[model samples]
Target: MRLPRPGEPRRQFVKRFLLLAAYSRVLTADWNGTLLAEIKPPKRPTFGMMRLRLSDFPALQNDFGSVRIGTSALTANNPLGLLYPILINRATQGQFYALLSECTHAGCAVRPYSKESGACVCPCHGSRYAIDGRRTAGPAFFPLLQYPIQFDGINTLSIELPDLPHEIEGSLVRTLPGAEFRLQLRFLAFAHLEYEVVFRASKTDDWRNVQFSLTPEAPLNRSFVSGADDYLNLYVEPAAGLGFFAVTIRILPV
Candidate 1:
C-alpha cells in the first residue's frame, strides 16, 4: 500500500480516493470471474421486462445477421408500453444475445445502427454499444444490461424476467355490443395497492372516462361492458374496421 504524495491536485486526490475505496471492496469480496467497479442493485418490478421467443424474430433465423427489436407484454403497468422492447442479435447458429433496449447513459431506447456492424446507437446522446451489450463509444461507461435467454434447441425460446405479478393480457374477440370483457388481476398476497383499468376505443385514442377501480372487497376479478354508449357503439362495426379497443391497468399508490 502506498500513500498519496503531498500537494496532489484536488481532482486527482478525489479520483485516487474513489479508486482505493473500490479496490478495498473488491479485495473483501469473492472474485468469481469478471470484476466491476460498481454493482447496480437488482432491477425492481416496475422496470420493463420481456419474454422473447427466438423463432418469432426473423433476423435471428439466419446466422450473423441484422439486429431485431422484439417485444413482449409486460406483466404490469409501466409508462413505456404494454409491450416491453428488447434487442436481439444472432452471433451464430443457436447462439444469440438479448439486451435491454434502454441506453445505459441517459436511459433512451437504443436503436440499431447497422446490420453489418452489429451495434446499437443511442439517439439521445450518441452512446454506442455492441450487440453483446458492451459500451463501444463515448458518453457511456457502463455496459447495457443483458438478460438470460434459454432455448429448447428448437423453435421455442424463453427469456428470464424480473419477478412481476401475473398479468391478464391480450384481447377478447366478441361481436356483440354489450359484450363483457373480464380480467382477473392478482397481486402478491402481502401487497396492497390502488388500481384502475381504463378502456379506449382505439390503440392511439384516449381512454374513456369510465374506469374500473380495484377494491379490497372484490379486487380479484373485474369486468367491463363495451358499447354501452353511442360513441362506443359507433365503433362496434360489423366489418370490424374500428372496433379495436384496449384495456390498460394503472397501479396507484396506496
Candidate 2:
C-alpha cells in the first residue's frame, strides 16, 4: 500500500486502497503474531490513554531492551492484524521510544531490536532501523512511524491514541433448517479494533458466548462488499424457535 501523499486526505487514501484490496484477487497471508493474553483497558472505555508500568517488563529496565504491546504477535509482514502492534524500546534511563512495527518498504513488521546489531531488522527485505526508528539501511527510505510517549521519569509510560468507536455497523441473517442454522454476519471493522460474538435465546435472556468452533473460520473479502466490512458465516445449533445475536467491538490497548 502506498503512503498518503503530502496534503492528501488520509481517510480518503485509506478508503481508496481498501477498495483496491477488495477487488484484488490475491489473498495476502496474515503475517502478524498470535494475539496476546487479554489485558483490561482503562475503567472509562472512552479514555484513549495507554499506561504501562516499566516494572512489568524486565527487558525495558535496560537500554536497547524492548517489548511489544497490542493484541497480535510481532512479525515481519503487515504489523497490522486485528490491531497494530506498538514496539516500545528503552533508549536510556527515563527515556523510551514507541514505534509502529510496520516496515515502510512493504508494510511488513520489523523484527524486535537485536542487541547484537543495535537495530531492528526487517526480515522481508533486510531494511534496518535505528533504536529511535530512523532508517539506517535501505530498500526502505522512510523511517518507521513513531508515536509520542510521556514518561514520568520513573516507572510509568503513557501513550495516547485516537478515541475509539463504541459501536459497529452490521446486519445478521439466519438460514438453514432442521438440526442446525447458519448465521451470516456482516460488519464494518476498523483495523484497530477487536470483536466478539455473543448470542441469546430471546429478549429476556442474558447474552452468552458462543463456542469457538461456531465462529467464522475465514473472513469473506469480495468486490461487492464495502472495503471496511467483514463477512462471517457462523454455524449454530438451534435451541428452539428463535435466537438473537450480536457482535461486540473494542479497541485494543497500545
Candidate 3:
C-alpha cells in the first residue's frame, strides 16, 4: 500500500466531516437492512395513539372528530383502546345526540336505521333508540348516555361520551434493579426519543416495561465494546415476560 501524503487544513477537515455525515447513509449503512436511523419519540403517555385511523370515520370533522373514534373493527381488548359506539351529536346532524350505532337495550351494537325509519334499531331484541339516545321502544329502560359536542376553539374538537373513556398507558420502569433490559444500537444520525422500547412482561398479563428517552437522544449502555454513541450492546432481561417474550419499538411520538 502506498502511504498518502497529507497536509490537511482544519476547516477542510470540518467540511469533509460534515460532507461525510451528509452522505453517511450510503457509506456506513448496515447492508443487511437490520437497522434504522435514530428517531424522535413522544415524551408523554397521553400522546395520541390511534389504533383506528380517522379515514375510517369520514363523517367526523373539526373538533367533533377529535373525540370520537371508530373502533368497530379494531381488535385491541382494552376498553380505552377501543373507540367504537361513537356519539353523534347535534353538531354532526341537526339536534340528534346519541351513540348512533350502539343499541340502547341489550348493549349490542346498534344498527343504523334505513333512511325510511330515521330511528336506530337494536339488532338483538328489536328495541329502538330514537334519532336521539332516548329509548323509543321495548326493553331498553334507560336512554343511551347523552353526550354533547363542545368546540375547544382549536382545530381539535371535544366529544362528550359516558360509556367509553380514554385508556391510560402503564407506568414506566424507572428502577432497573438487576431485572432490566439492555438494547444494542447503532444510530445513523442524532436521535431524539419518544417511547423507545416496550418489553412484554413474561410473568403475567399485567407485567410490562415501557420507557421514554430522557435526553433528546438516549444515552447508550454497552459492555465489551468502546465506540461512539454509534454502537453499543444493550444487555437486558426485561421485567415483564416469560421465555417467549416480545418487544415493540416505539419511535413515533404518541
Number of the top candidate by lDDT? Answer: 2
Model 1 stretches astray by more than 4 angstroms? 1-52, 66-84, 163-166, 169-254
How does model 1 score by TM-score? 0.43
| Clashing residue pairs in candidate 1 (N, C-alpha, C atoms within 3 angstroms) | none
My TM-score estimates for the predictions, one after another, are 0.43, 0.49, 0.34
lDDT of each: 0.40, 0.52, 0.33
Worst 10 residues of 3 by lDDT: 15-24
Candidate 2 clash pair list: 33-73, 76-109
lDDT string for model 1 (1-254, tens) is: 01123243323311100000000012224111111111122256443233344444455566554343322222222213332345665666577666776777867667643455557777778888876778999698898788786666777545554432232222222333555332222221211211233344454565443333243223334343322112111111111234222222222210
lDDT of 3 by residue, 1-254 (tens): 01111232212211000000000011223111111111112223322211222222334332222122232222222112223335443234323343534455555655433334655566678777665567888788877665454433333333433322222122123225544333222221212211223233333443244443332234433112222323222323224323221222222211
Q: What TM-score would candidate 2 get against the native?
A: 0.49
Stronger candidate by TM-score (1 vs 3): 1
Cα error of candidate 1 at position 237, Å = 18
Candidate 3's error at 208, in angstroms?
Answer: 21
Candidate 3: residue 125 lDDT (0-100): 82
